[model samples]
Target: MDWTGWIERWGEPGVLAVAGLLVGLGFGFFAQRSRFCLRGAVIEFWHGRFADKLAVWLLAFSSAVVLVQALVVAGGLDVSTARQLSARGSLSGALVGGLIFGVGMVLTRGCASRLLVLSAQGNLRALLSGLVFAVVAQAALGGVLAPLREAISGWWVVEGGPSRSLLALFGVGPWDGLAFGALWLVVAVFFAHHSGWGFWKWAGGIGTGVMVALAWFATYQVMSHSFEPVQIQGLTFSGPSAEWLMRVLSEPGKPWTFGLGLMPGVFLGSMLGAALGREFKVETFGPGYSLPRYVTGAVLMGFGSMLAGGCAVGAGMTGGAIFAVTAWLTLGGMWLGGGLADRLIDGRHA
Candidate 1:
């Protein structure tokens, strides 16, 4: 069907909202069932077991690469069309930002998306993290840290003149991208299959990755197509989390964007999932010291996400899926930061 004909039949906003709801439901369900979390994944890895979480994350990244490639072929979607994709080659910022975000995630015990889902489950620590994430993200975007980001971005040079992603760094074509994605999938599957974890968790990890890929498809094809002018498609978290807060206050004449609509849907869907599974519980800081720790962790996470340009899910999982160079840097930074935090915190606890 022609683009215009499809729009006329469904109406942009209505179709977009439905797409948001579907993406939300999928995200919520997967997160709740598999407990898929980047922070947890890295921690599990560091502990030398429960590597299944890391497998799940890799599975998601592989799936996204495949799915996005398929969408580009099928829907005539162009990766170069999106600003997020084009805004590549920020290596220095990504490394620094990722380290901060990663450390913050370890301290906070969750990434941005995890914080959102956990908050819905009445986790007070997650709630604090989400609040802090929003504020710090805003600060980095336009407030205190904006200048630093701009300077870093300006100083970095792209060897090949900004292309779609890091794939360009290696001069990879679509076929090469596919091959690299398959390599990751093979590694993830091997880990899951050989790990001592039961089939249920292994399958759940794979399922989580598939769900994330589905989210990419839904956003790019279903939601973006529903718009009149058609917005650029991408999956990243640093800016969206902050945008959601502003959207809440400026809802009167606000134009509905996929990111804005999908976030709340994920939150509500998570709440519903928790309730249905009888897993809903109100968890909070236990005592005097815990509250301060939680708050401090949340604040750090917020600022860190902003500096890195997204949270674990935003830059790590989603952007990684599409092979974005900055996302990879963010992932590395997160790992470095999270690793240090874990050692420090564990040492202190010991």
Candidate 2:
């Protein structure tokens, strides 16, 4: 649709970048306040800990699902061009990529988003890992590793299959977002029943979910109303991190992008959170040889997230409610990999 001209007309680099920064800042603030990491939340629940964190996670995702669906229905947003919308990435890629990303998150002790927040909080170790992750992700997107990524994705494309949510199989509805959201909310409420998280923590979690949906709505507004259409993407960290890094190297003269705004916002917001909590401290790897683990994990995450098409934040929670094939497949793979990491890590200490 001659998006280039549209970008020129409406996507004033400054405005778009600022919009992205605001969205990112909202996400970072809420996430930090809530301590929201899907990996940690799910794993904590798995360990027989109370499901407060799990409830928080589910509530956020389900809430986002409800709002995102409603926004699309209201015609306030259109996501036809989003990465999550394609629904045709290679299943094989999802499997391998999801698993690898999960394992990497375990090694690094956090996901891509978590690493960025940590980096901002003065974790030099996290900064290094985050850089490696962004650089490697860049390779998969269009650098030396692009050919390999393309080849793998081409090999296992989920061609000719319905890309809609599992609910479609029931034939009762198609993208019945309200019903879908209701079901998730019900589940979340049920879990929340026993959770001990105070009202404020729960609010933070719910706020995070709303922000996720708001990201979609905000980006959609920009894409639909402007004479020029920007890519209709929502919040995600993996590729955006790389995009920002690559731009710094190649397009140093250009201002930050809308998508790129989230990375720095998350970092800065997290730093602010830490400072407020008196938890801000420069952290580094201690003796006992931690560098290899972090490096390997970062590399795996970089490639795996690219291969799987999204991380937990991008695919598991955001794409998850949509019933996208990649969402389910990636989460499934992440579960397997995360479980494996749990066992390996436990055994190492044992």
- Using lDDT as the measure, the top candidate is 2
lDDT for 7 (candidate 1) = 59
RMSD of each: 3.0, 3.6
Specify the highest-TM-score model's number: 2
Evaluate residue 190 in candidate 1 and report its C-alpha lDDT on the 0 to 100 scale. Answer: 79
- Model 2, range 1-350, lDDT digits (tens) per residue? 44345456656455567667877787777777777777676476557665766777888888888887777677766655666655466778888888998889888888888787777778888889999999999999888988888887787776423453444445543358667787988888787777764774577678878878877776666666566446666678877888888787884676556777777777777877777767777989998549999999999999988988887788777777556677788988887887688667744332
> Could you give candidate 1's per-residue lDDT for residues 1-350 as a string of tens digits?
35446557866655565566667666766676667788877887776665667766666667667766666656544556454476545667677778877777777778887888888888877887688778778877887867876786566644323453777767776677667778877887777666556554565566656655665665555534554566555545557678877777565776566677677777887887788777889887776437666667776777666666677777777777667777788888888788778877755332
Candidate lDDT values, in order:
0.69, 0.75
Q: After superposition, how far is residue 60 of candidate 1 from its true place, in Å?
A: 2.2
Candidate 1 at residue 120, lDDT? 84
- State every prediction's TM-score relative to the real structure: 0.87, 0.88
